[model samples]
Target: MNDRDRAPIDDTRFGAITVRQDGQDRIEVHGEAVPRVTLERDPAAEADPQIAIGTRDRSHLTMRVDGAEVDLLPAKGRLARHSYRVDVEYDGASYRLVPDSVPSSRLTRDGTHLGDFSSDGDETVIAEWREDRELRPADAAIGYALASAFGTGAQPMWMMIADGVSSALP
Candidate 1:
């Protein structure tokens, strides 16, 4: 953990979030007027296109920024909770998104816990990041998708709570 007590956060700014669902298989992530990352499924024919190939669940997800494509590959993770994971590199830094059974997921980089994000099966999502680390909006969006209904084994908060309540009743 970075020293939060030694010094105030030097730079930990969060881009104002606006996550919009364009269709059944698309999510647009925007900060201010510029788009950060657009996560969606690619047409079967162009899935393994010019971009680098991928692995794991083969969800065929396309990660785009301003209509330009970037590699969004899947990786092996705790599949008992989530279907797959996204392990990518940005600015020479490696990031991993791990999904959970609840409506939330974990974000780690270089084996250090960075943050968590969750979605309530709607356009709005919540992202909490470590105060000392820089925030990457793209990671937040991917984690949100993995925690929301868009990904496998993701259940909403209400459903989990109701299940717990019902299970407890005699």
Candidate 2:
């Protein structure tokens, strides 16, 4: 665990959030068991010229956090029914979700990819800087995808709920 992981616990305003990989995508948060998930079959299993080469279909990805499950795919519409991959839109920024590999997932925010996560069988490790932010349902959904693809713990994105402060990127 690092300082970023402890901020929420040390500061009650951030609440006590603990995300650690237990098995597969399953995680433990504050002693609560978070469920693991696999990629759902894409409705449009057809080849997508947009997806990176070597990438496979993973339509539905779910992540459980704090007793709540968040689905990364669209909740409604044709894309929800057809596309296995989904992009997240929030605060004017778009987060593109992609399955780089079976044990890796990538989240690209506004063209500048934040980072990627990989599963080590026993734990999840982020390849770049990981920050805590106040996340919405869509944001949380993406977080879960990262956890599932990387087989890591979930990050706390509801900072505002604990302390009315803005930790999101500008």
Candidate 3:
């Protein structure tokens, strides 16, 4: 099904072409069926929570979208909130989702530009991406994989300390 046939974003738990919060710790990407993909915190992850993307057999820090296993790697930075600075590739295109200060994030592909993700000071995540129908699903997966940086109770002790230290220097 195409975008036209898909359910409205607010009507679906997730969107056929977008991602949405299922609860505090779980998110779902709706499409094809009720939830084509789901992302949640990996209980076994060390330090900061590693995201598990996909349905029942989800993998940590990886999102299976558009037939590609996009690994959300921690883009090298001085912070331990590993998910906040994420790098991934999908449909053979490289993308990075980095923080643009608090309550906002930037998503760039091949270092060109796409859009940004910002919080409404609540549990909701809002994204403004270029009007490209083809990339919407990929963008949703990539952005939601790290969107928790703006979610409540997501910052672990290590992340707080790392961010604090990094902010103090330079």
Candidate 4:
């Protein structure tokens, strides 16, 4: 549906956080600030807005916003983990801001490797499912939370998480 009908993101001095429905089962997260970020949303687009992340030559990650694409890249650093950020717009609002640093870790379960990644470093967050499995309790909870926060039906949560992490550069 429209963003106005969804829950409003909490606004802070540094930035604001918002969630809006994309398609029937998709929701988008937007973060924005004055100089560091901007937020926007438009409904007449064909695809959701997106953000791409990686080195100039290698694009390993991406996030789709109101049908557009924004590139996310890591800041220069010697550490194994790097900070990735991007801009996104949807439903008539534009979010042009860098995301906060998210700490990523390698995960493994039952001989299956889930890969190395992290949420936005915020304990209260939701993500989409990527690996092959039915929705886990935690992930399902996240979906429900997101849906409740944005006022939408339950949808995939890991998609947002994967997009947020894969787009980060090493």
Candidate 5:
């Protein structure tokens, strides 16, 4: 679906950002510094995380949007926190995606509730807003960044950390 038909973003979450984009490489936020967007990945990611034993390492997709960066980390295990989590910090706002088996995943900005993205059918994912909020064009920019970064299904470096943490447990 288009942005117009999508759920609205709550004012308390990102009402301050009055900018938007056309799914392009740039996003301008009102009263916030614009970030330089880039798509990059570490070539020396041989020591990245892995679920299956293999000498070859997996490279994750990284997107640098303005001041914040978004990394899509592959799932280390079946029950990994998120198959791929986006660690992002845009302008002065921070965004996170917490994936769950039910109701899909939750998106938060600066510790505030933004909305929940769930599969609507076989081809679409819908975002359910917490409050009666209006989604800004800037919000779509963030989503585009995430989609670009995670579209390749690369494994993020954080997955190794999570795996290490899990291994340390008795």
Candidate 6:
């Protein structure tokens, strides 16, 4: 498949947060210096929560309290919106964690592709491939850096990451 046919990668470091509560209900957040957005939890608010946090720019992160898994969408703003249905087992119960999909238009003005912001079917297929794809750390790092460097409202960062990877490919 051509590079254009692949799902876009977001490498921008919009920001990150590590939360810890000092033996209290309140949570303490830390990360690289950036505007702090609130961590919106599930309605249940159960301990050891499984949560997905999204930003106005379409950046998102899904994390589990017990650290069983953590997925980072560093450049979510560059791609289309799609649903991620995750199953989590906690406290002897299985909770289906399906986050609201971020709209594709909101992510970029490049319009939708087969896997762009509005195609859940395409996103799911690409995600599955990503899990099995053998990508070098350097390639991944370069993709991330390019996305961050070229970010702006006018140009889609995903496209930039794609171009970077394509040019680097043998």
Q: Judged by TM-score, which candidate is best? A: 1
lDDT of 4 by residue, 1-170 (tens): 36565554443222344444333233345544311111222333233122211121113333343334444232332222312222223333332222222433322222233233334322233333345643222222222222222221111235556766889957
Every model's TM-score: 0.57, 0.33, 0.53, 0.24, 0.42, 0.18
| lDDT (Cα, tens digit) per residue for candidate 3, span 1-170 | 34354443442223434445543345555444332444454545442323222222224434555445555565434444334566676667887777665556777878766777765422355666665534545555556545643331235447678888999999
Over the stretch 1-170, how does candidate 5's per-residue lDDT look in tens digits?
44445443333443332332323222222323223354444444442223111111124344555545554343433344465555566566667665644446566676666676553211133445677655544454454334333321223447757877999999
Judge candidate 2 at residue 113 and give its lDDT: 55
* True lDDT of residue 87, candidate 4: 23
lDDT string for model 2 (59-161, tens) is: 4233333344443443221112123334554446676655454445565667655555444422233333235533333333344444433342222334323
Candidate with better TM-score, 4 vs 5: 5
Note the Cα lDDT for every prediction shown: 0.53, 0.38, 0.51, 0.31, 0.43, 0.27
Task: Give the residue spans of candidate 3 off by over 4 A.
Answer: 1-26, 31-37, 46-60, 76-83, 120-123, 130-136, 149-170
Error of 3 at 30 (Å): 2.5
Query: Roughly what TM-score does model 1 have, to 2 decimal places?
Result: 0.57
Q: Which model, 1 or 6, shows the larger TM-score?
A: 1
Candidate 4 has its poorest 10 consecutive residues by lDDT at 49-58
Q: TM-score of the candidate numbered 4?
A: 0.24
Q: Give the CA lDDT, 0 to 100, for residue 21 in model 4.
A: 39
lDDT of 2: 0.38
Best candidate according to lDDT: 1
**Between candidates 4 and 6, which one is better according to lDDT?**
4
Candidate 2 backbone collisions, by pair = 59-84, 135-157
